[model samples]
Target: MWADKSYTEVTFKGCRPTEPASNFDKSVDIQLYTAGFGDKVGPLKHFTKCFELSTSTATWTGLPKGLYYFKIVKIGGESHELKKIDVDQVRVDTTLAD
Candidate 1:
């Protein structure tokens, strides 16, 4: 999903297969970085911060306005490209109030 100014938070959802009759336990690691920086090196190396979610759904908040690269890491250390978004810039109404 794209991060835009209208939303204050970002949510990611995914599913994983678990061993039958065993406890369903797993986590996902989310990383964010400046646009283009993420691809030059490892996601973890250039990440701004890391977020872990035990369930399939994850929500990140308090993100600043800018272009960011997103990635998701599975429990086994596999990384998946998520998306790049330029947080929608807020347009201010400069005209004098009518």
Candidate 2:
């Protein structure tokens, strides 16, 4: 590998059940850790409705009320080491009724 690199992302969602929200439908957050970046730090990317960005976070809203969970993925190349983050689903309660 040429050099070690890492990334992180997070999404914030707000809903009122008035409209369906697809942006935060597949939103995710992850905590990254690797030995490759001994001293150097990487950037954290936030996504809102599949929009790739380099900001601290992505704010979303206008979604139905329901339970939701966070999804995380560890990215790596062929030459670089790969690690998958282990996380569990969570319950997100909303006022919307199905």
Please report, in order, the local distance difference test score of every candidate based on alpha carbons.
0.34, 0.28
| lDDT minimum window of 10 residues, candidate 1 | 85-94
Report the lDDT of model 2 for residue 3.
18
lDDT of 2 at 54: 22
True-structure lDDT of candidate 1: 0.34
Q: After superposition, how far is residue 51 of candidate 1 from its true place, in Å?
A: 16
Q: Distance (Å) between predicted and true CA of 82, model 2?
A: 2.1
Per-residue lDDT tens digits for candidate 1, residues 1-98, read 24333222233323342333133223345554546444321233222212232212223344444455545543333433332212122122212221
- What would the per-residue lDDT of candidate 2 be over residues 26-70, giving only the tens digit for each residue? 233333233334322233333332323222242223422222223
Clashing pairs in 1: none
Candidate 1 runs further than 4 Å off: 1-8, 18-24, 39-62, 76-98
| Residue 41 error, candidate 2, Å | 29
